[model samples]
Target: MFVDIHCHLDAVKNASEKIALAEKENVSLIVSNSVDIKSMEKNISLSKRFPIVKVALGIHPSEALSMNEKEIEKAFSFMEKNLKKAIAVGETGLDFKHAVTEKRRELQRELFKRHISLALEFNKPVIVHSRNARKECINILSEMNAEKVLLHWFLGSKKLLFEAIENDWLYSIGPSVFENPAVQKFALLSPLKNMALETDSPVLFNGKPAEPQWIPRIAKKIAKLKKTPLKKVETVTTNNAFRLLGLQQKG
Candidate 1:
């Protein structure tokens, strides 16, 4: 079984069809994340309709950049109320790469700090999205003693990547591993024990949106990078996903 740890299923036009395709491919689980309350609602429905779908509800960094104080409060409050229905506390973290203004960037940081606090409060893992501000995000998480962190679509300096690994943080890579030298190097040199795979569906892959069915190929690439067998990659990554999400299998 394979798991795509982070994907915006709600953003996809044919999300239901993608879910069916994933099951046929033996991609057993997908942790669908939300960008806002509306997407969270759709994500909740997806999880219900397809048992393989799990959820991570939170506002995106770019979305948070435009939110006002009241809207942010309402979003967090809703999360506090509905966290039980989800597995993780994120899709949150700083994104200086996209937010572009110091003021809005500051706002992003503040909101991200709130998310980290809430994740600490709820004792749930945070699925992070850090772009240009990887070091800043790592600093905030470290200062807060965030115990369960997963940096999805991670792209940053190798030094920072190693720092995150040293802190025992998990990183999720996707199909970009083939094209992005940073992702390739990160997946290649980083310990497989601390690594996992994601499709980030609706994300373009050679001009088309990617899907969960592509997880096996990406996993194979990572395995080859590490000079490890396919099963080891599958086992280690699957175990890591279940551990970070605190998922349990029932007979």
Candidate 2:
């Protein structure tokens, strides 16, 4: 079974249709992440409606720094109240590329650490939303002794990727493999055991938005890069994703 390890189903208008298409393509599961409280609820509701959908609840990096203490507390409360309904804590991390103020960036980093602590406390996986702050994110994850860290749409330096590999942290690659040379090189150099497939849908790639069904294409690209067979790549990626997301392997 195929799994898109990171996606935002809440951002799509025809999300159900997309999920149905994934099912049709033998994509047995999808791990949908959220950007904030509203989207977290939306993701949870979507997961409830579809048995194959799993949820990761947390605020996005861009939204994280903007949250006041009361708002942050409210999110924490809500998460504690609904912990059983979600599978992970994330789409949360530092983003230096977008936030305008140093203060906001600092707040975002603080929130990232909070989320990391929460994930460790819960013993749940985290989906990190690292953009240009890869070193800081990696350092924070290491300092926090965070287990089950999944870097979504990971586009860090080769050194950081190697660090993640050394630590056995998971990395998710999206459809960017079709055109992005750096991402392609990362795939080529990465062992299949350390990587999994994802499509951050509604996020444009190469001037076109991605779809969940493009996971197979991503896998095919990986196979070509790794000089392995498509089926082998598909099988290993599926297993890696299942293990990362804590899903049982099918008989």
Q: Which model scores highest in lDDT?
A: 1
Per-model lDDT: 0.88, 0.86
What would you estimate as the lDDT of candidate 1?
0.88
Model 1 lDDT per residue over 159-236, tens place:
888888888889999999978887888788778888889999989989999998899999999888888899999989
Weakest lDDT window of 10 consecutive positions for candidate 1: 242-251
lDDT tens readout by residue for model 2, 1-251: 68898988999769999999889888888888888789889999999899989999888888866777898889878877776678888789988998768888888888898888888887788999888888989999999888798988887788998899888899988898988898898888878887888998878876767778888888888999889999998888888878777779769
Tell me the spans in candidate 2 whose CA falls farther than 4 Å from its real position: none
What clash count goes with each model? 0, 0
Kindly state the number of residue pairs that clash in model 2. 0
Any idea what lDDT model 2 has? 0.86
Model 2: worst 10 consecutive residues (lDDT sum): 76-85
lDDT of 2 at 51: 92
